[model samples]
Target: MLFVPLPFVNALLLALVFVFLKKSNGATATRAFLMLIALCCLQSIVLGLRWGYNVDALRFVQPLLAALLPPLAYESFRGLVDQAAPGRFRLAAAPLAALVILGLMLAAPILLDSALVLLFLAYAVALARIAWRGPDGLGLARLDEAAAAHRALWLAAFCLCLSALFDLVILFDFERSGGSHAAILVSNANIVSLLLIGLAARTAGHAQTETNTEPEPAPQTATSEDAEIVARVDALMTAQHLHRDDTLNLSRLARRAGLPARQLSQAINRVCDMNVSRYVNDFRIKDVCTLLRQDGITVTEAMYRAGFSTKSNFNREFLRVTGMTPDQWRKAESRDLEQKDRMAR
Candidate 1:
């Protein structure tokens, strides 16, 4: 039997995930997410070769690949919130900096290791800043999927920070243990980080399908009344049934209302006292309630017709809005109708 390295298995699993995402998402997978996953797979393979197989030559290549991961993960997530974010050239500086560090490592090997730790920590902070805005901050993600995307951003940030910690642990082990425990620590810890980053990339990939080609309008900074903004959005939702589009996002809504995404979100937040996703789901739940009261419609049908994509979300939102499950609400509504019929008779 051939001895298969654990890191090699990790790489193959990531490869499978990459293929699964490609097949499932097709063009909907953003280039950044695809690149992020591909790099993870490559890094895992390099880890396998260098540490598992004891190939000393790959030491030079591994850190350079590590340099690319954080920026790509950050870019993958930043696109969810900011449509007008800086281009890839700006992020390319990380890998270029890594290249220079790689050269410096010949004289001071710790240079590359220390830089990788700091690079991961920096991008982790960047990712956490975006996630700190909550689901509404992901203005470009579909309203139905923003929560999931937000969670993914958080996990990605945590994974980066954890990766940095793992590097630090490996550095400590080298100093204290003559690098005795380095292989186990690297194989177990780093592989898990790679898997988590891949999963986060996959979770956030769904937002890529809701692409908008229209250039985002400049945000309006005028002191327009919040009531006026709410009225405009309400009128738009009523007249155009914008809430019926599950792909509706804050950016698109802001674009339609002739307001900036942040400004619109702030208006909704202040006026409705709820996040934009919750506010929009209120409209959807209202429509679902109306449909549930009518005959010839199933709960699933009502959920889909009212712009809900998943039963779990639909049921959760329904409960939040109505204080009852869909079934309970329908039964209670039926009893009210029966009582009305009896009184009329």
Candidate 2:
């Protein structure tokens, strides 16, 4: 009996919801979510192609797509933490390049098989890097709780690595394997990977909602020194436009503000009622609005100048903050500007 797991169907549904949430949120998250979805879609296509076509070329393409998935996902999560915009063409580069390379490699089965195996190995290494390093300056402390977003990613990474290992084993021992055993292992691994990814999507969605729902902590009394530090950081963010710096990280921001990174993070969290990423994103969002209103700059250029690395992220964050997409925001800004022009006339 050919059986597909029910969890996969549930995962697909949840992934769709994540896509909607990401699209609503507008920038890096959206791009990340889209990359995630694309990976899943390609994975599904590869499965169908393998069985239906029984082509070595399709087999070669599957692992390449699989290799590209984790890096794109990590990049997406990085965007979420920073709310930094992403480059459009740059975002497309990995998957596009992977496809092009895989297409070329298909001319020779021996070469294609070896290349595909190497790609999966590299993918495993990349996933390990992300898992080990964590995000931004945020630590594994956040993932201590079972419900944390990082836990889902950790689980997903584990599943992907395991799947890749099994794939390598199958490839190396293809001639020795019986059909039933190979089919069972492949099916089971696919189901496990799908389940983990679904959990990750759910976790991300829940984390976003939880963050929004949590009440702001009450303001506490600050010593004069603390107050001064807060004021300086805020002023630099607002007046000096320090957040516009792509290289502007907590350590640099702290150095610029003449404070320790820990103290700066505490000050921003306690005094400003936000994290560093949110703080920087607030400025980027403001710049996006200003550019939309001005009418001279293209949206892509605005996103770039505003320090966004991807359109999906920019769009997601813009919509989340302002309740409108960049296009919608631009149209509304243009209308207002036109109305003002009429009044001046």
Candidate 3:
């Protein structure tokens, strides 16, 4: 009555969801997605054997499977977030093959428990590395709404890793105390972790499809009207310093430029090669640099005068464009100014 069939039911559900996602969207065709589903299925099968068939031997399989799943899931989600082509066998095949070999070694029931624990620890370390690197090695700013969705997926993967770590701890406790409580605890933990992983898979699949299918906005063809529009917006920005307004939205900016909102959006996207927020931030960041360098304004005051609502958003956009923080920009400017001062002296 340990609800033995539950794991298989979960596995089948995961498999069905994955297949549907894969068929519906090419973007979801990622190794991470496939591997995660496979991991769930394997875990379910092993758990069913342990429960229904009284195959105590299947217990050794859990740690190895758990060890590999999180990092692979993290890596897959990372690739999806970045919109980069995922690596082939290099990413998942090597570790998966190793896990299979290790599982075979454990088949004899003579495997050293310490070795298996170490393997699990090593997998955890690898997962920690993936979490640290984040999406695309570009850090958080590069993550758009789609990338953020994938980041949330990675967070779920982290939780699964934590659950596995907890299982290892319980196993250690059982080893010392000669109790069967760890087995029950691990079974319950698996059920919970499997549910979490299923949710992550669904999210990742949705994110992939959503990101890939989103149509790119049409570019504005250069025309006399386009030039006039740019000139008008540029004049307004120069005159009113609208660039400094952090709350500057599309409608307001469109009104200032004397163009309709949709046309204004099209013009900026076509001409400037960025969205309205990014377009505004580009000028704001430039003004911030100028104020910091020429006027010796503090970053906070510069940010406010440039129209940014918050320092955090300012820093994020600044880094997105310049590939450095405002503080970094200030320091670099200071160094250059110091050099100029020395020459003057």
Candidate 4:
């Protein structure tokens, strides 16, 4: 039967994930993903034994595991991308565990089927929205080191979507025909989902385990250490005139100051009271101010020389820093000079 190969494939993937969990460093995200893989493997084993071998003992728990798939998949996605993701639903399992015992006792297959359909539909939509936003939407590290890891998150989103579709197929098939063919179909689908989810989990595990991205060097809180970091960044910016580069960004300043990009961003936000980009623009605006006071220098030239690439951004930053438009500031300075010359006459 087509169902014969399901258990073996699931078992193999289960063993790989078990090894992954045992050998690799224990990160929360990696652990959650491993749990997802383990759940998939168990789902495969249960579905295969129930339909393939006509075993009744594991049949009752199959739908319960089905109910778990959506939330578990979403949780795994959250773990792979963000370590701070909530596992509050894991607590819901205790009550669900009690219900699982009741389902086994009563053999209420309808309840399990209904739960699986609703849960998968809701969380599948949630995962799809996350995918729509891309890797940056997942809150991954904003560094080049995480480039390879972005693909993994994309794969994770794709796998979650496919898993949702697979659940719907299984649900529809089970409702229309509770025959041997349906069992074969369901068993085969579970096996396929297991393999796909295993790939996703493995990719996610690799991203989390690998130290490719810059680790967060400091906390978000305002600490006494921020003053020291801010001072160092200020010295570097002023000494090297780094604000003259139109392409300047947080990472470059962080590198120049010998601090982590996250720490540098946080220090600027805390000590200088603005984000890294705004703080840099403030410096650029100051340069623009100096150049504006001189004769024969147009506002456009002043803005370009101050490292601004676009007129709109230069105007925005100029207004934000000085509370006046570039032209307004220039005309005001000219008026002051005229008044001084008139007094001298």
Every candidate's CA RMSD: 3.4, 13.9, 14.4, 13.5
Top model number, TM-score:
1
Which portions of model 1 show Cα errors greater than 4 Å? 85-89, 209-224
Count clashing residue pairs per candidate. 0, 20, 4, 0
lDDT of 4 by residue, 300-323 (tens): 998878777667667777888889
The deviation in Å at residue 14 for candidate 3 is 2.4
The TM-score, computed over Cα atoms with residue i paired to residue i, of candidate 1 is 0.89
Any runs in candidate 3 off by more than 4 Å, and if so which? 1-4, 23-28, 57-64, 81-89, 96-148, 209-345
- Local accuracy of candidate 3 as per-residue lDDT tens digits, 1-345: 455466667677777866765665453345466667677777867776676466887766655675566556566555542344557754664477457547656574444344445544555465455545333221212212233444555556566556657656776776788746655655556666776666666555543421211122445576677667777887788788887654344555665676665576667666777655576777888888778875657888888887775556678888988898888887887798899999999
Give the range where candidate 2 is weakest over 10 consecutive residues by summed lDDT: 209-218
Model 2 misplacement above 4 A: 1-29, 45-49, 52-61, 83-93, 100-104, 111-114, 131-147, 178-180, 205-263, 266-345
Clashes of 3: 4
RMSD (CA, angstroms), candidate 3: 14.4
lDDT of 4 at 328: 90
State the lDDT of candidate 1 residue by residue for 305-326, as single tens digits. Answer: 8999878888889999999999
